[model samples]
Target: MSASSSRPSYAAVLRLSHARRTFGAALLGRLSYGTVSLAMMLAVNRATGSYVVAGTVMALFGVMSVLLSPARAALVDRYGPRRALGPMAMSYASLLAVLAAVSWRPGAPVALVAGAAVAAGACTPPLGPTMRAVWGEVVRDKALLQRAYGLDGVAEEVLFVSGPLVVGGLLRFAPPAAGVALSAVLVASGTLAFVSSPVVRGVRPTPAVKSARRPRGGRALLQPVVVAGGVGLSLGAVDLLVVAFAEQRHHGDDVVAWVLAALSAGSALGGLLNGAFEWRTNARVRLPLLAAGLGLALAAAGLAPGLLALTVAVACAGLFVAPALTTAYLIADESAPPGFRTQAGAWVNTAVNAGGSAGAATVGLLVTHAPLGLCFALAGTVALLAAAVPAGSRMPTPTTA
Candidate 1:
């Protein structure tokens, strides 16, 4: 047996030196991402009194954030997280604060709000990528690292689900801008604690010569990126399709929420299970299989007889979501050259977001004209096609650092 006699638990992963403090602080900072989207959109809509303006501003914000992520992560790879992440977080938080102030009341200048959003988005810290890289440094054991990534994925799923609920609760007592203000504080304080951790302090910048020697091309990333993008596209279509399904069947809007909750529940469970055991096959082979399973499940969802069956099918599709993403991150990390891991992870992150955005837009158009079942099939087919990307034979074995 290659691994230790004792299987590494999630508890064991956290038990690694400095893992708890570092991971907790990183989650604290990442929570800002989950909150800021809903908060800012509400703020912009209220201040401008136009969904058009709000949507456009958010589009700019999201596009800048997603497109520039790899560039930001590359900075971290070059200068290390401590040196690179601090300034980015501070600038991002400051911009959020400015946007909050500008949006505190109705009739704020539209140009000023849009400018602030673009700047804030561009400066958004690559916290997720940075923290994943830190996990690489803190836990050298391969099995433990797998658990760490699983735990991280599950926690992130929870944060995203809860963050919007928190904002919804807050809207009862405070203005939407208050949520934005809170997001600013969260990122600022969390980043401070994160950079101060002992383990993070030890992750020094890669030497210039070593960085120069690593391959800069995208060949190693082809498999994971394509699968991740496909997964994103499929999931993105699910949200709108579910809504259309509900409305067509005379179900209320709240049904959408319940169904989506089931999906999240399935994903959380799958992530936990994915980490609990070691697999004989490495991530390269597992990646496409997980993606294909998702595609099949989603396509079957279109054939569901009623809301109950659709919910079940969607939940089944969600089972593959977290593990597929976790596996993609693993492949991205393993395939990355020395000093390039952060950028590699960021590329995968970027693909997911970009694909999701495209999927939502494309589905939005198609849902209006086509049969709901056909639209669902089209989305699932995207993932199926991506799964066909060949996993080359000469893949690296998963190894401890």
Candidate 2:
């Protein structure tokens, strides 16, 4: 047979199509989630005149989402993405609308705020799991799968960086209420789009074999999968330190926004590079080195002076961010039992979010009583320590079929 004839033909084209659709769905979901998140934070802060309260609300949202994520993922696994998206979107919109209404009313009860926070948290759409499951189904090639994940990671960074800016602009130039309303509309529309896509619609839940029963909590949190969760916690600490450091330097409250954007832009660049490179090293080796590099770069940022210096340092720190994240995803995918993949992913995400909250709260206290630079130094030091932990240990092999 001719070499050309031996190569796969239409199958390659079909895979590309599926990848494109998956990317689109991810993009829309992220954009919607980011926008609403930004708007909600801004609105809550404005209404309450207390960032502490706003932070509490945000934390509650994260906590609830984390706690319920597995359940949400289970819903998707059982009924598919189409059925899950509709209720999630509607619930999300309704909750936001109620929040807006309560905020507008004079002397709104604290209960209203608490209720809003819980509702918002509970209704987070199963975007991450759904997209991940789709990728698992559609992309058969390992390299292509990695590239797709890199792209998704980059997209997430972009959404977080840009989404807030958009909300801020709307709230500043237009009306705050308008921003909230816009967020609701975007989220609902995006959810609808994701559900309606043929690729998403066609994804049926795989039959669970007897061996793949639901895992007990302790067992699930053990294993290399949990180690990956630790890595996420380390990253979260790094992020918190970056923000606290920026705030301490009198870079303004929005300094976090700028630094985040710079870091995200670097991560996006890293993702693209990850796609282009054909690395010969195993993930275990590459991931630790990458994480260590990130730690060193973050340390440099802690020692740097001024916004420009900090920005450069942040960007450099971000160079390894996406690679480390991709590595975590790969590990989680490999280590998780078949039926528990969604829960595994959720646990990773929850650990990251929880770690971030802890880091931020801790750093905030340190900065309040101690020097700002000290807070940055501590954060950088912790990150470096975290990076070293994985490096010193024997790396696990990537599991395969």
Candidate 3:
């Protein structure tokens, strides 16, 4: 095939009937995922009148989701997303609805609400990872396949950037229970449709390839996966640092909004533009450089003279965000064993979350005692450490043509 055959425009990728259908359904499935936490915390706090109780529920949810993600993805690996998505979507949504109702009732037990929240998280459909897994099947061209991964990273960032605002805004006019109910409905219906799509229905899990020559033990997560998560941890730290910076200046939420928006816009642009050009750099070399670049950017953010300068610095740093993330996905997909592709994707998700937790905890504890720059430095240092992990490890190359 000609090289041109491998590189379709974004419009072309979405224009394929199957691709179009799949994207639409996936969008709905995702609409609530990023926002659900806000919804849950609000309802729980309102019902319990205690931040401690609310926080506990949210923490448990996070823990359950991380622990269960691999198993859920493995189910998709064995049964196909078509079968796996439904039970998860329905069960998760139903559990959320029950939680919302419990929160609404004045006398509902806190433990009951917590249990439902835990179940909802454990039941999260492998929507994001599965979509990425299927793209390998849908797009035949290696170049286009790479681009698709970039696009998926950008889409996921969109959720992170917008999810809180959307959930918060809706919660303003509606009750917390209403917000959660809506979230449940959206995730359920969207995932249902996503699984029902002809294109999605046809995608099967990657079968484990066999080779006695290849060394094997317990697999999926390894050094590369840790580095992949480091990307998230670093970002999460920078995120909180930006908020602290804004608070330090007494600029409040408005400034914080500007700071995050700049980062978001830069990341979106970088992801779109990166795929347009192929790099001469090897994946091993490219991955670490991009990750370390984030550290440098975080440092720059700390050094900016003022708010305007910080915004510019953050946007510059944001430019590297998507490229680094895209590389992480490429690494995970390339590094894992065959039967473990879906499970590998789950590991990446776990790493990111685990990293975020570490970042948030470390920064939250230290930010009050140290200078904002110190916190930023800590975040930068963590990312650099993450970069080294992958640099020291071995990752097999692309198996594709």
Worst 10 residues of 3 by lDDT: 212-221
Q: In candidate 2, residue 223 scores what lDDT?
A: 30
For candidate 1, lDDT tens digit of each residue in 89-156?
Answer: 99999999999999999999999999999999999999998898888766667888889889989998
By TM-score, the best candidate is: 1
Error of 1 at 81 (Å): 0.6
User: Could you tell me the lDDT of residue 52 within candidate 1?
Assistant: 100
- C-alpha lDDT of residue 260 in model 1: 92
After superposition, the stretches of candidate 2 with alpha carbons farther than 4 Å from their true spots are 1-15, 48-52, 172-174, 213-257, 305-307, 369-374, 388-401
lDDT of 3 by residue, 1-401 (tens): 11224336666566556776787688778878877888889899988888999999998998888878878888887678888889988999999899988897455688898899998988988788788777765676756766777777788778877787887888778778777888899889889888888887777755555541154422323555767677778877877898888888888798888888998888888888876557668666777787788888888788887899999888887887788777766666665666666666777778888788778877888999999987777787777887776344443322321
lDDT of all predictions, in order shown?
Answer: 0.87, 0.64, 0.77
**Clashes per candidate (backbone, < 3 Å):** 0, 0, 1
Give TM-scores for every candidate, taking all chains together and pairing residue i with residue i. 0.95, 0.82, 0.91
